[model samples]
Target: MTRKLLHTALVLSLFLPGCRLENLSADQLDLITNSVSSTFKAARPISDEEEYYVGRAVAAKILTSYRLVNNRKLTDYVNLVGQAVAIHSEKPFTFGGYHFAILDSGEINAFACPGGIIFITRGMLDAVSNEDELAAVLAHEVGHINHRDGIGAISQARWTEALTTIGSQAAKTYGSKDVAKLVGLFEGSIDDVFKTLVVNGYGRSQEHAADLASLNYLAATGYDPHALKTFLDRLVARSGGSQGGIMKTHPATRDRVDNVAANMPEQKSDAAHFSERSRRFASILGK
Candidate 1:
């Protein structure tokens, strides 16, 4: 009996010795990967959670260096628009707070950051001719926030230094050097990556994703879907076909407009009415 028991124990021990425990379950890996992708987490392309965190940390620092336009009314008004559109976003506003700010910039631009921080340049606000136009711009930026564009950009880890270097000959793109460094975790290092993101601009695919998302949001909100196309048309015309720095990296505004027009849904439902406050937008910006 003792010999038989020893044999059984020995067999069990041998099998157990070869077995190894797994820290991440299949579900866990899928969750992390898909969730990050869905949110467009910036560190994703790097394929390291730590790298995403580090790059994002650098992104945060870069955001602070710019001069933000301070107006409680403007902030509140923009937030109202953001929240309304956000409720219908793919990811929704469950992750974190959605913030809106006005930057004292002359360029017609708006941007969304990871976790829902959004900014519209004073210049972009100046470009709006009506409530729908303004909503179109805000909705477009909100679309980026909702679809996680900023995070996605940070997640993609390709070295864009050559393009960035070419872009840095200008002054506006120069300030974003610190943000570009975070890409170094990939093939390069932080110093080089940060320089790249600021100068070269996000690739065409990202712009397409953002444009699609914006159209979806605009349709969802009952805003004229064509407003985005109109704005881009104006921008192209205004730029005299140059495509400028921002448009240069983004999908051709004309192409995107056509694409959006073709796919827009016919929705007659009221998009949660908003106080356009046209005069307020101009007055708050001191236009």
Candidate 2:
């Protein structure tokens, strides 16, 4: 476990500022010390902190392509709901934790960066019929984060090189020369995650995995897992002639719907609570 933790810290160290190393608790510091004796060639794991920095870079790259929505109330509502459901995920506490944002575009898409930063487009938000549906959408993205699918996009060579360099250094703090090498690796890492997640999209198996994770999170949080199927059904119908955003990035809706149906959890409906949740959602989005 110490080696695993140290490997994670080393992977995260690429973009981490030297000053932040001072903030590490005794345990994290000890892990770094122990890592000096270990060879990084065998193992490389992206730590929570490293994931946060990588996710931030990816988020910045995404912002260049899409404008962010400036509605404070709606953004707060999303963050609240996203955090509530994210708490039940396997890897819950990332470096800075999860943050939910909205894009101003009308594209039917959502993006989940390496760590926990998630962005949902306006059109996607508009498609959700209720709070449960919105939760389902967010849960899917959370699944991606839980599975570390974003980091999986990074090249094997990059991971090996970065981890080897950090492990050789013996501490999170690095010299200026080390920093230069890391900066190059950092740029490459960012490009890997951005191109794979935002451009090429995850593979079919990954999408299925995320969808399964979404169902589990939704079920664990008491949100109807069926809401995912319903939302995807609507999204497919609403996807007109142009296959942009999710239509372009995600797998076929019919396939996703079937998979979701096969793995959906059973829950007794509470009409009263459901109605109240729906009312709040409508009021918030002015639907």
Error of 1 at 213 (Å): 1.6
Write candidate 1's Cα lDDT for 71-118 as tens digits.
Answer: 778777777767767776786654445667787777666665555666
**Which ranges of candidate 1 are over 4 A from the true structure?**
1-59, 154-198, 243-245, 249-252, 268-287
> Candidate 2, clashing residue pairs?
none
Candidate 2 lDDT by residue in tens digits, 1-287: 56655555554564453535447666655544444333342245777787899899999999999898989999999998899789989977888789999999877788899899999999888878899999998999999998888988885757577666775665445455665665577468788888877778888888999899988988888888888888888777777655677877775567888998898788866789789888889999998
Clashes of each: 13, 0
- Model 2, CA-based lDDT: 0.79
**How does each model score on lDDT?**
0.55, 0.79
What TM-score, over all chains together, does every model reach?
0.61, 0.76
